[model samples]
Target: MTEVGNRHPHGTPCWVSLLARGVEATQEFYGRLFGWEFHPGPSSLGTYVRASLNGKNVAGIGELPRDRPLPIAWTTYFAADDADKTAELVRGCGGTVGVGPLDADDAGRLAIALDPLGAVFGIWQAVHHRGIETSGEPGSPVWNELVTRETSMVATFYSLVFGFETQHVVSTDFDYLTLQLDGRPVGGIHGVGRGLPRDRGAHWMAYFEVADTDAAARQVVQLGGSVLRAPRDSAYGRVATVTDPEGAVFTVIRTEPLPA
Candidate 1:
């Protein structure tokens, strides 16, 4: 298991949070689905709840602001050394800053932005909280992926903003790019294929590691969620896509165990 203590390097997918209509129900759904435990954040932070695995922070959940009701979805946050500078880079690269380089109490400075292709994401400069405390284990985030029609344009935009080394995978079925930080794969970019609905547009999706993809998918259904894609074996492992009761989508994968 990878236990992260220090701040993540720039461009790494450091954190993710779900903005839902009902915080309590969201908490219970994930807790029952992934064996996660939730701890409420400071009251001043509204209804934010940190989801943990084995006592380590894995993700966060909060109610959608009443004034600015957004579609229930998980937002992927990439690490940045300077939130303001990253926001500026986003704008300069034809992206739009949707939120702020605003302070989140003493936790960090954060800003939400849209990529040129319209995928919304967050940038975080950590202070008191250093993003997810544990990763690459069941119940923790394992990967973040961007799906877009503008594969080359999106690739160039992220590479310019985050200094990521893009590695394109050769495949006739689909176009895929791996974003690397210091030569280590951190995230991926997938070209939206014809098989997907045209109205789907561009978006960032988070994937969580699971011990059993079929079992997790079943739990999701039992907890009022729906499985968009049934569990299927892939080159990577067994994978499934599911949506919470509020319709926030995420992927789960049962990866092959590493050689001892």
Candidate 2:
């Protein structure tokens, strides 16, 4: 069971998933990283596997289309009251609908979509499935963000569809827009070629929680994953950017402890 009824001004973000190249490899990597266990599950879609951390439902990883070219990446899902309606809103907001408001067995209705700037995300109408319960913990999702050249359009499109109002600083020189769900910062949008190398296209990156950012970064290198950026302290947490052996980008964050 998932933690339910957590809503925001826009809508509740319920589920998160990933499409992996070597399903077994991803399963092993993430399971080792996050202490999660994977098992075959009954899905309305083709084949689905539920990922559990310490025996609790945490996230999911699925196989991509073997018949076509695709990238291995994590996909974040925002909770929707009606996935089909949200898909319409996405199109109306100038975002493209890549997939469907199709059924995923009894899990819920889902659709793959791109923001106006082409960053991808998903919509989930959870029935039996709620969403990711433990985020900001080692092996679970800590954060998700998107980068785009059209930062203004990204703000307007998401605001129009999901009602997310972005938070940004005017004088900072960086075009960083924080995705606020019901006033709480959920994700962010940044300009391309800023704080990263050129040729890095617009994409969504998920951050996993870790107990020690330094140790995790070392482990990433030891395990053959490339470290794009070493651990650095931010106002939110200490983080490091990394790419998996397959070249999928992600983050590892260790948040600062709150005052007692």
Candidate 3:
């Protein structure tokens, strides 16, 4: 297990990609939610924006082409020393790499990989961009959690590749294992088993910390994002499930109070 304060064996978590049908609407919605500042990314990737709040990159937003059958969603990215190596590790462990070990100019090299149960994630090799520099604080991303049916395999795969330690202990009644690196909880993994809707397949879901759950949910609806679940009290905090304007699903939880 990586002891407390150990540097991330792979690299820091960087760039998060979000899919939005209404790019302009999402830009405004999250702008209100996180107080994020945005700027255009490379001109070739139209409608993709790099998001920062308080001068730190926290997430990203872009338009999803309607031609594709893909669902609207937020896919998180983690930096790797070698994108190719990370892709190999994913395949060796029974996951599928849907996209490339391809380069994105001076920005980085990247590939999209899905776990055996089909939760997609991005492997990033940073060139110009590193990652969200500040986290676990109010108004920034406090945590990311992946939920799936193959809990132990998902845990083992990441542990072997990234050196993340799986804490047998959980944070809330719903949490499975605390995903730790250098001894602090960076994210978590949860087992869906028979708990979720019967037709819902195993997938990765992320949680963004918010100041108020009710307000955020309302903004989601206002911005064209659908509400899958209403705000409710959980053992950990008040949480709600929502889909972005593009149909990418995620959750938000109110942990600490927002600035008044």
Index of the highest-lDDT prediction: 1
Worst 10 residues of 2 by lDDT: 1-10
- Candidate 3 global CA lDDT score: 0.74
Question: What is candidate 1's lDDT per residue for 155-226, written digit by digit as tens?
Answer: 999999999999998888778999998889899999866644454568899999998899999999999999
TM-score of each: 0.94, 0.89, 0.84
Per-model clash counts, in order, read 0, 4, 7
RMSD of each: 3.1, 2.8, 5.1
Best by TM-score: 1
Off by over 4 Å in 1: 1-5, 42-45, 193-199, 258-260
- The total number of steric clashes, by the backbone 3 Å criterion, in model 2 comes to 4
| Alpha-carbon deviation at 78 in model 2, angstroms | 1.1
| TM-score quality measure for candidate 2 | 0.89
Candidate 3 or 2, higher TM-score: 2
Full-model lDDT for every candidate: 0.88, 0.76, 0.74
Worst 10 residues of 3 by lDDT: 1-10
Clashes of 3: 7
Tell me model 1's lDDT, rounded to 2 decimals.
0.88
